[model samples]
Target: MTADEPTILATSAGYERGKYGIFDMRPGPIHHFAAELANAGEDAKFCFLHQAVGDPENWIGATYAAFAKTNYRASHLQLFPMPNHEDIRTHLLDQDVIWVNGGSVANLCAIWRVHGLDEILYEAWQAGVVLGGVSAGSICWHVGGSTDSYGPELRAFTDGLGWLPYSNGVHYDGEEQRRPMMHKLIGDGTLPDGYATDDGAGLVYRGTRMVEAVADREGPLAYELRRAADGSVTETPLPTRVLKYQ
Candidate 1:
């Protein structure tokens, strides 16, 4: 279900507790919104990328079990010692949606570069395969962002996929250290003007241009940060389209 135009949906949210699953987790409303954004059919081909978490096999199994209750054909691409798929590009481009899980984004980017997943994903993005994810997954698509990849302390991350020109901030409301770090990074010119999303919310981008902000529930929204002339950053709350939980 590739679109004619490229798309990326960055968010601070991920899977939530499910009433039906071996792992008791299911795709949230924001996840469904990603499927709709990709124009996925009833039986969607969803590929999960968990490079950030070292492609843990336990979560991979859980992802399969969770999707089994629904119609999505769940699959995962692992890059621990070697790539799980022979042709990584083909596997990614074939999916209706590629959902990335959260972890150390610095490690994710490093491993992706080693395996050439970065360029492969770039091709997938150009081919209109819906590319989106939460946390580390969210930050990977932007020019830079605040990441705790090094440790508990947050720092500016400049090396990203750069599919989106602006920086990105994830877990805006959930983490006390997130918002202020993003502000400092943008204000100091370490990162460009960017967007930040509170938990359960995301930003939709079409060909590098933002289309809208989407949330799975109320109160969780997105923010646009711009560095003002006097080394200050303005955070403007954007209108959010809340999705009804199915």
Candidate 2:
């Protein structure tokens, strides 16, 4: 089950490919931590959404394998082939936690809006289902963020589900363009005051209010960004508590 109120874990953190298997995307310790955050009990219900990456088979197999050993009863919602579930809304709303994969934020948003998942997801969040992921998954919950979905060069994208009521910057430290672009977006009023996360780090929001920042690994951190009166941006570092697997 999820928390009593809406909980969002927006981050630039997710599975990593392992050399052992061709499609083994290892869900790191952060996965366990996220599950606990959702307050999932003995048998957790987890759902994965891959619309951001076109629901590639290789990635799907990798993600399924990632949850194979866990107590979670894992499933996925696919959009490419006419939806795998008969009632997408019911299936998602029943989930305790929903993890999304990163790919094309623009395309993901467009498709979700077309299929009415935007509303469905919002309903799930209101019901206290923990929703989150990396990159595109992270951006989808915010008002907007920097995206390279169009090309190699990053662009400001404001089309988001807006569950958190702020813009989000994913991979803030890993990508060189993310910081400056997000700064410009906030400065020019293209986006409102927001948060940014380095790789492996995330922002924890409870009911549209930021509660804390968390990281799977050391060194990575999250930031709060705001625009000054002179049209400049100021970033304040948020204390991050590193999470470990229980």
lDDT of 1 by residue, 1-246 (tens): 876589998998777776754378877787777777778865778899989999888889888876777887888999887888998888888988899999999998999999888898888888878888999999999987999999999988999988799999999999999989998999999999989999999999999999999888889999999999998999999999998867
lDDT (10s digit) by residue, model 2, range 1-246:
777789888888887558867366666766676677778864778899999989888877877888787677889999996799999999999998898879999999999999999999989998989888889999998999999989999999998987678989999999899999999999999999999999999888889999999998899999999999998999999999998765
Could you tell me which residue pairs clash in candidate 1? none
Model 2 clash pairs are: none
The superposed Cα distance between candidate 2 and the true structure at residue 202, in angstroms, equals 0.7
TM agreement with the true structure for every prediction:
0.96, 0.96
User: With candidate 1 superimposed using the best TM-score fit, by how many Å does residue 76's alpha carbon deviate from the native?
Assistant: 0.5
Q: What local lDDT does model 2 show for residue 230?
A: 91
Per-prediction tally of clashes: 0, 0
Give me the runs in candidate 1 sitting further than 4 Å from their true place. 18-22
TM-score, structure 1 vs. true: 0.96
lDDT of 1 at 51: 90
